[model samples]
Target: MLKRKLLTYALISGLSFSMGSSFVHADVTKLRLAVETTPGDPLNIMLASFRDTLQSSAEEEVELEFFEGGALGSESDLIQLLRAEQVQVLPIGSDIVELDSNFAIFDMPFMFADKQTARDALDGELGELLADSLREKSGLEVLAFGELGFRIISNSRRPINTPEDLSGLKLRTPGSATRILAFEMLGAAPTPMSLGEVYIALRQGVLDGQENPLSVLEEFSLYEVQDYVSLTNHVYTPITLTMSANSYAELSPDMQEHVISAAQEGAYQTRQLSDTSDAELVEAFTSAGVAVNQPDLASFQTASVPIREAIAERLDAVFWEQAQNILEPR
Candidate 1:
């Protein structure tokens, strides 16, 4: 199955490049988009929609070639490639916060009451502020915001019903400093690791558990190694659709418009897919023998208050306030 998936993308890359080159009469704007995630992940889903929309709307004016499943390397390596213009676009994960701490605003635990509230902020000024900061700091232009969705903790140990339930469990988290601190405050020993390494670690007893959206848990097959899931709805992670500044500047104005509009469409599609897919994915986990529970978030939220204050000064003052205004409870 994995071999077939790789061969499919290889054909896509070759065909896209050939189509772009064969347009002798008209100049084709070629863009390379890479991601560490596999084809069916939400990040790739958004990019696939973005690519198709661009193709249909622009009609040979633009061609997008994908290098997915970490073909180019980790998200960190991909960022360096974007800066060097080796790749034109990427759907960057929370590792982006490492570039500019202001992006950490999205890493706050229990920040949004629901996915809709998170979408409202990402599609509004709060998102704009972080995007502008990213451009200034790293020269990547943000096109749209998609999601990694709200994360829930799953473990091999026990069903987590409260913050106390998390005590001393070595949980695998993404490489986000704020996220690490958030888990620590909730009483878990957070271990930072890449998604690709998580399954073996869980199965071999190197990790007690990890947190992610249900889609990710299913996509990565992490549920196979775990026994319990606690729907803490702990953090809402946004994947930023970004283009290299060099690539954007080189595009004709009309082509740039096509890219941006297509990105917005893809972003909306991802949110809709995530909203609908969770209910089904949850059942799949239960059927696989993984116990599931939706714990009351009040206790988790209470434990996270001090961590919020701790990271407050680490973020941009203005951006922090704006984020709170958009996502904080009414």
Candidate 2:
């Protein structure tokens, strides 16, 4: 977190949550986990596994309730819930940067050379650094870094074979300034949109396409609307499964350890899903009638240099250099 224009968690304290909310339980120490990903998405799958793992290991009676498919609202809504102590945990995607700009470093185009190196960065000190920043800035407990994997572009218009191919395409991007800037440098007309609005926007021709991991495409039914899948791998995003520190601090030490261990289990499941699906997802797209192409990744990687460097420098030159050091060669 840059420490400039910071939004404090205290802002959400005055709000009241409905007692009848499905995610809350009275008899047991219940953990409510919120996610925007559709039910079958790998992140959700990991969350479900986490639920089982935590409940089984917990010393006392515990329950984990999940709100998926944006049922509890957007990622921003979940953050507010965390602040209000209405939810115990949240598996948030890259949009987390909206709360802390330095989180944008995770979305910096081509931040990790490959999935393993990225996992190493996150599972190691780099992950702890971001966790410390999150706790310091927002009063959230970073359970573990969840994976979003490599982002690929999909379109209904033309096949994207090169950076030039993206020109004039109405590409839908997350609300990250760094991402928008990277796409612009690559020549695409990037439109910042929420995930909930993306499918309809693509289906109705309002959006030429969108970018996400392959699992998102299948889980969200993007394949039905988008005709092409380009392995652009423009960004590798690691999401966070975070808890409200206030709620966490109230737990018994034993329960707290169980929760922490379960989160690690969830992280493992998340990474394992990506390792197995990276290639299978492409085959899935092809089977679903989406034309898949391996574009000249070098072209997109090259286009990202100036924009990524500028964004990284503006964020933190020292931290960025440190991130580079932690990176394992692809």
Best by lDDT: 1
Report lDDT (Cα) of residue 100, candidate 2: 66
lDDT, candidate 2, 249-276, per-residue tens: 8776877898889999998888888888
Q: Residue 50's C-alpha lDDT in candidate 2? A: 80
Find the number of clashing residue pairs for candidate 2.
0
lDDT of 1: 0.84
Candidate 2, pairs of clashing residues: none
lDDT of 1 by residue, 1-330 (tens): 477457545545654565443322348777888888897899888888888898899996776678889887777767766676667778977788887898887677777888888888888877888888988988889999998899899999999998999999999988989889888888899999989999999999999999998889988999999999998888888889998776687778898899999999889888988988899988988899999998978888888888878878789887777776765636
**On a 0 to 1 TM-score scale, where does candidate 2 land against the true structure?**
0.88
lDDT of each: 0.84, 0.79
What TM-score would every model get versus the actual structure?
0.90, 0.88
Q: Candidate 2 — worst ten consecutive residues by lDDT sum? A: 2-11
Query: Model 1 off-target regions past 4 Å?
Result: 1-26, 326-330
